[model samples]
Target: MDAEYQSFIKTLRAGHKPEFPADAKSIEYARLLDAQDKLSFLRANFNIPTRSPLRKRALDGTVPGAVKQLDISNGTKHVKGDAKEDAPSIYFVGNSLGAQPKCVRQYLNAQLETWASIGVNGHFTSLDNSPLTAWQDMAADCAQQSLDLVGAASASEVIYMNTLTVNLHLMMASFYRPTERRHKIIAEWKPFPSDSYAIASQLQWHGLSPSTSLVEIHPDPETMYISTEHILSVIDEHADSTALLLLPGIQYYTGQLFNIPLITSHARARGITVGWDLAHAVGNAELFLHAWDVDFAVWCTYKYLNAGPGAIAGAFVHERHHHHGHHHHSTPDPEKGVDVVGYLPRLAGWYGADKTTRFNMDKVFRPAEGAHGWQMSNPSVVDLACVRAALAVFGQTDMRALRDKAVVLTGYLEWLLMGLLKDNFGEPAFRIITPGNPLERGSHLSLLLRPGLLDRVSETLAAGGVVVDVRKPDVIRVAPVPMYCRFEDVWGFIEVLKTALEEAR
Candidate 1:
């Protein structure tokens, strides 16, 4: 421990906080805390960006902050061109996009070398030294690696496939079987826009009016917080007519981690299919889709999974639904379907076909059992490579251990912000919109700055190399991700934000 903190603790032993500024208020205190962290070593697995090249945007690295017209389809890439001289940025936006894993480069390079050496032969061949499997088994390989992350019953219960919304669309195709009497879908009031659009469009496509068929459980307007009780009441109100209940495991904007097991049990008992948009929750929160009996779930890996932007997404089809979805006689996606031998009805692809007969050139479609049956196309091998690398870091530790770190890390950030945001006039400049209860949140804390202070605060924060998600008009979502963020980063953010607020005032 730092001498100052040690002294402070001695003072606290006498039942008082140290009066000196050198106590818990110094960067040394943050450093002391970081020095004791067991997970601090985990930070080395990521490529943190240095301040000097944070704005690079061109092939020759010329743009600043302006969105570049480059091929970022692979995802946001972080670098350290001037890392030697400059300090690393305090990256607190993992809730938006996670930092690039250091191993992603190695994994991608392996894929490239294999392809160059043995073109067609690479599909079935994996180098002994490579950290990946043969091309055909890549998605399943990722799923196996992710079983513990999603809390699946077995490898067969999980699969990595299309992006979040597409998987949602696919899962909804089978699970959102609407009848004349039970056609309504229950959702939260403030789902990420894409989710809202997907749900509405699905209703429209089914010839159902979204105005009547989509039931949104409204949040308390003053705080924009959705309570578990409110969600339950909404489910009760529409239980008989609701065919599906889809909500985010963690609300992206508010960072509200829903009570997955409770909500799933409540809705499913009412005969409603339960699905979760776990885009922000997968790697951020502890999940038990199988144990909780979730009907299905969809998630994007770009956020907390650190698999880069536009990474191949993931889906969970509870083992119970693997073969029985066709019993509902749901409508097909039209563009991609085949008369599969399996009992379930899913959009089929050659790659989704059972491997034994995948090369048989037969007309009959035989989907591999369980979640693999849901695959719609050949997954991007490069994307799978990135996910493999990301999972490798996760493979070193489980979510239980990560969650323990997250609670303390985010709690430290909240504790520091609450104590430090005092202005000369006495009233604080911001209020935390995310729930203070640790069980109800994940890694993010949504700080709603008092009206009119956002612009100056954001400018200062960006200038100080403090990356955060800014919600225009007032809020900033700061995520102290346990995977790579430090207690020092949290302290740095608070120091920057506190100064920014004082200056704005």
Candidate 2:
């Protein structure tokens, strides 16, 4: 084993936290925490962007706050400086896009080689001379790696296929069946826009007005966090009319991790099918779709899963839903021109047909088992290759271990941010909108800045080599991923943020 790997194993055996003073904001204290970190070595497995085009001019002796004119002589170029090229940027934007894994290139190259040598034949053949299945089963292979992360019972319960919004629409097509009595769809007040759009459209498709058919549960005005009681109350209030309940596993803007199992169970008991948009929670929070009896769920891989931008996303359907009408096959209703008496009516494609008859060129659509049945088309090989590489890293360690580290790492960040407020400003420059309780949130922290200061503060942090994302008027979201981020990165970010806040003032 390599020295770094050995050191990581040793640290894991010794437990994660160090005996550093909780209130200490020194670099030495951060280094002490990093030394005892079990997931620190995983940082080397990723390629962190060391320098940004935005920061190059600053490094070339340009004034700190001065905006340099871009010399677009040769399509924009930066003059190299003596800046430390090996130092990684303090990347706290994993909630948006995760840092690329170093192995993705290797994985992509292998697929490219296969495509070059075998062409169309590569679809049914293995190129690496391995005993694994062919490229035809690539989506299944990718889903296998993610089963544990989402707490799925079997591989068939999950399949990586379309993007998050696309999958949300697809799942809603089948799960959001409405009748006269149960026509309402319940969701959070400010879900991710895509989810809100899809849900509203689905209701409109059913010929119902969103104003009456769609129910939204808002956060407590004072706490800015949605209480479980509030969500439960909404479900109960609409129980008689509710046909479906769609919610995010984690609220994107506030960084709130909802109690999914509790909410799912409550909705299911009320005869309402529950589905989750897990784009923010899939890799960041521990999930149990099958155990929770969640009707369906969707998530993207680019954020916490470390796949490239717009990479293939994932979906889950309970096994019980899979065999609902298995013994009975659908026949077209000659009168209405649709199959009215079958399992869940879905937007079907050839790719979702049973494997045995998939290539048979039959007129009848015999759906495949489980979540695989929801695939509308063959997955993009390049996208699946990226997912494969990311999941390979996930296979090295389980989500349980990662979550354990996350609580400590994120807790440390919360601690440092609070201390920075107390020590520097002696007043609130910003308040963390995410729940203060560790169990109520994930890795991301949403800082709600004082009115009109969000953009300026975010820009200052970016100029100072800290990468975080700002959401509209006043929120800045920072997520320190456990796979690649270190305690030192957290410490450096806090220091840079202090300077940024001062500059903003």
Candidate 3:
């Protein structure tokens, strides 16, 4: 740790919890905390322009204070009105949806205006003189960003598409071709509801019973996170009949960064087609899909990527599996019990027309190279514009610098929460379900509230204007997004949390 950090810790340990302004007291204490480094890092890494009109309005200076003072009895007040103090709510639900960057609105508006002026002929308009409706290149650009995020070899191997479940279903249609002998799809026991449902539906569509074809991997009885070693062992045990292994890059509930390389490697070695749900991993962790030889993966851009809710999602197919210029290396072997119809289903639309004569023909279908081959419908123009705006920030920033900042910010948040929990509720009031090791956890910390305090604590925190989210029954997920969240935010969160706990008691 740096000297500044050590000094800050000393000040924090001195035991004088900072005081927040009474009008919006919950967030004021954060200013007293030594969060300069964390805040500086965010300002440095993200293109958070303070002087821009878009940013100025999005930030609405002083709104954060109002958020800190909000009461839940009033009901989700952030959207209720124009209260400036309500801005710094210390949002922790990046796992659900990320706060919008101030710049995205301007970007979207530019596109909207361009569309309005050019009308139906916007495709060949003068400004850029490029086809506005041509989503092909947009898909390619998003693929490149997703590739860098997941360590894929080429842009062609990835594709941007609909939401997580929709993309998962599409990939399953192409990859999860199961046979009677090796037809089981192995997934986490508590996999996100959408994933579980999609996998079940895919199996049912193939005339197979989910009970016999779906394999759910459970963690040890009392634990929420799965053990990497155990997952590999299960794959080994079920290798004979396991056709696919679908796992998440990070467990959403536990914030556990699973051993992607090891797990995917083992499954692939045993002829299992491995895919990943990266809803929680895409922008939070470093990945190496190409190096790891993962068959495919999908993610939602709304979370850490800061794309708007229900924004366009992304998918990655290993370059080895993509037929960019050449033919597919080899069809998945049938002995592995993966079924293939020997042809990709065709699309019926003007965009799907064969490129050579597409302009002259009303209908034709010519599959593009690699993962682009998977695109069936036109991309969402608005969503792509927002994502393009977000990726522009990444273009200016290095992931390594962001990752370094993340380590400190998240670690500090965890440390403060544990300390506060110990001081008030004693040892076992709540447990950090997110791994203690930095390597095992990502930006979020999932705190498992003590048995009976879950409801009251959650309700109290929201009423107190603490913007963390709770998974029903026990888990409270707190994310200190390094790009936007400050160390002061982390400190303030703990203070409010302690007050909430006391109030609950």
Best by lDDT: 1
How does each model score on lDDT? 0.82, 0.82, 0.69
Decreasing TM-score order of the candidates? 2, 1, 3
> CA lDDT of 364 in candidate 3?
33
Q: Which stretches of candidate 2 lie over 4 Å from their true place?
A: 1-23, 53-86, 129-133, 324-342
Model 3 C-alpha lDDT per residue in residues 1-505, reported as the tens digit of each score: 2554545334433422222223223344344333445436444333321112223343333222222533434333343445433245656666677767655756676677777876655444434633223444566666776656778788777778777888788788878877778899999988888898898898889898778888888987676768888899889889989888999888988888898999998998998999999999888887888899998899999899988888988887776654322222336455633313233432234443334544675433444556676776677778887887777666656565566666666766766665566566444668888876677777888988877888888876665556777888888999887667776667667776887777766
The true-versus-predicted C-alpha distance at residue 125 of model 3, in Å, is 5.0
Task: List candidate 1 stretches off by more than 4 Å.
Answer: 1-22, 57-85, 324-342, 422-426
**How does each model score on TM-score?**
0.88, 0.88, 0.81
lDDT of 2: 0.82
- Superposed Cα deviation of residue 38, candidate 2 (Å): 1.1
Model 2 steric clash pairs: none
Error of 2 at 289 (Å): 1.0
Worst 10 residues of 2 by lDDT: 57-66
Question: What clash count does candidate 1 reach?
Answer: 0
